[model samples]
Target chain A: MITSAAPALSRVHDVTEEVFAAIREVRDATVAALAPERPLVADLAALRPLLWSRLTTGPLAALIAGIGFIAAPGLLADAPWYLEWWQQHPSGQPRQLLRDLDPASSAFYDYTHWEWFTGPRVGRERTICGPYVDYLCTDEYSLTLSVPVTVGGAFAGAAAADVFVRNFEAAVAPALRELPKPAFLINAEGRVVASNSARWLSGSVYRGGLAVTPVPGLDLSLVQGPAAE
Target chain B: MVSSGARLAVFSPVDSTARVEAVVRRLADAIVLGLLTDGEQLPSEAELAARLGVSTVTLREALMALRQRGLVETRRGRGGGSFVRVPPDSGLEGRLRGLTVAELRDVSDHYAAIAGAAARLAAGRSLPSDLAPLRRSLDEMAGCPSPRLDGRFHIEVAAASQSARLTQEEIRLQADIGPLLWLSRDTPEGQDEMAKQHQAIVEAIERGDGDQARLVAERHVLDATDHLIELRLRLQD
Candidate 1:
């Protein structure tokens, strides 16, 4: 699989690397903001201007729908769970997303259990969380690329960015189309992120074990296969 | 225009095989729902095709179907393109009258399955804020039979379920036959009945009762199906 699909896999690798690089900037800034002292909840406010600025002017601006820091449980002095997330509105202004962190609330956003948080906490260098419908954020099918935020060798939280699958498809579909065979990008869970052929729809899990070339350094694979009938 | 949910369906990309039929159905449903109003000019074929991810040839086929159905008209030359022409009866009654009992039952059954499952999952998965959109839809339903709000209400439930596949299915179903299914909302009594049922489903979800939410959601769909069947019978009579 690697030998036959190396070029296509490289394209997928390049695009995924571009996305991770952007997310790492947020993660690096987060780690820096928390490094000097035992973190105060107010300290995260420094990330606000940075997030807003980057989301608006960054190279991945159009691809990323939201960007921010998601703190580890009890990492901040006053807040046990917090997400300093901001999503771009259709009007071009970005808005901060507020979710119930209270465990008692039925609407509580228990993001800690999500892959984006859990993967990094468990020591994965980077993670791609979903092709799931992000009802909580953009309400589009989204992929959350995240990196672990660490301070002094201790886990803190994750800095993540959201990319709507449609925009993602637009970005990489041309690349996938360049391949000689049907190809798709899948998260580690075998869920299809995007596909050049309609036979593999986004959000559908691909069960076939075909020629798979894993995108280096990310929990994603570029699989080449025949379209299912 | 349609609500956010239906708008997603309206502009969503379509695959090659289903391109013509999908485009026709989406535009037809939009017209029936009054999302596209009478005499309103549609975007050019090229633009519409691009947004829909289909070729201009396929879009022309869809436009021809809409013209045949009396839902759109095309004029050539300057200031000439396709324009919406909502049918006199708003196309709902006639379309309903056109259905056979079995077809109506099949579609209604399929909808109930989807709505029931979505409601059940939402009961377990939805955050408190997710209820806001559903509540707003109910509040809007109080005034009139706004199919847009009603369609949005169901789609929002699917969204609450946190499954994009379910959400997409709900949106497609709404665009396909939602106006017909929700035709009962046209009457004041029907409007109140629909709103109450929708509210019941929400309350069950709030209570975190998946079975109860599923029950209410399914019954709501089945009851609407019955009303549709009854109306269809009357049209036959």
Candidate 2:
């Protein structure tokens, strides 16, 4: 949204940049760690320390929930996972109970369909995929900001991180709210991601007037308005 | 004063149990965890019945079960009531030694989720006053990282998070595994290292750093689980 409040808008941009940078860092580190000679089938345990350390050690650590790889199929037989790492303690406490996930039971909705997985698979670009319900991971509304990890120009897998959606919205919504005119953060498909005014709801179509601008470092474009009659 | 967590966990309404069996397990857990101490007489039959939300008959049945297990000593006449007999260390150790690596990993993974969430919520929800208990726990643990106090250190963080349900769940988990977890930390190096990890989580909470607190808390638990798994493996060798 076009807010005169540059600082708040910049705040949104800063966090977006910071999160994407972490995803890029994971991709780069993963590529360097997995030698070309090694099997494309990744070792989750060996790769986890780097993900855990990179995600937890630095300034933006709090914003992330978990990070790891989601592989392309047939890479490892009997092991559907190329590598998967959920942050050690998810909500800020030690988990004393763990629900048994049947490794053999393919219960999850397909991961290949997810933009976080496929967008990078196709374009090989770092993609931010969410603010939606992550049925596969936290089972909460979250974001999966990811980048394609490659070995010798072959798509090995995608390195990704999970950020809860509430935190994502919090980081950007306040800035969007400071706008004077009717304004919205619309995704590529013209659906509202967030808005400064109540005339448009999040995920609803922004059926209003002109003045579209892109918020820096984010994929969503801002729409400023007067409803076109 | 009882910790906020203790208040929630200690006084639960246990109306939905299978009567005697649940009381027996509950009381046994309390005794082993030292929430009910040796030589400390339990409340009168009637008082205990009400407090436990069980009938006197059910409570008596549980007492009989505890006595049979050598966990309770019931004396008669004046100043007489059910009393706790400290759990046998041999039994505890034998049980510890019997555990497999897979079982210990399950415990660790579960602890990480509970403790990590508590630390995260504590950072956002805790007041300066809430921070006091965590500091108190750190000091108690620094001096002597006993099973009781070490477990309490983690529980206190959950309490500071101000989620009663989380605190209660934490208490149950801590009571179940907290004492046994000490088996691996009996060495001086393990104790000292645990203290450092505990300190990091505590300081992160004090500074209102939710991410740091969660990160440290999660790592601390995962580390403990790994140590236990390693020890179990070495014992097999």
Top candidate, metric lDDT: 1
Estimate the overall C-alpha local distance difference test score of candidate 2.
0.66
User: Cα deviation in Å at residue B217, candidate 1?
Assistant: 7.7
For each candidate, the DockQ is: 0.08, 0.01
Q: Residues B123-148, candidate 2, lDDT per residue (tens digit)?
A: 76555445665686687667756675
What is the alpha-carbon lDDT of model 1 when measured against the actual structure?
0.77
> What lDDT score goes with residue A13 in model 1?
77
List all candidate RMSDs to the true structure: 15.8, 23.0
Q: If chain B of candidate 1 is superposed on the true chain B, what is its TM-score? A: 0.74
How far off is residue A178 in model 1, in Å? 1.3
Instruction: Score each candidate by Cα lDDT.
Output: 0.77, 0.66
User: lDDT of model 2 at residue A188?
Assistant: 51
Worst 10 residues of 2 chain B by lDDT: B1-10
- Candidate 1 per-residue lDDT over residues B2-76, each given as its tens digit: 234323432444444566887887688777766789999999888776555457888899899889989899999
Kindly report which residue stretches of model 1 are placed more than 4 angstroms away from their true locations once superposed: A1-4, A226-229, B1-237
- CAPRI tier for the interface of model 2: incorrect
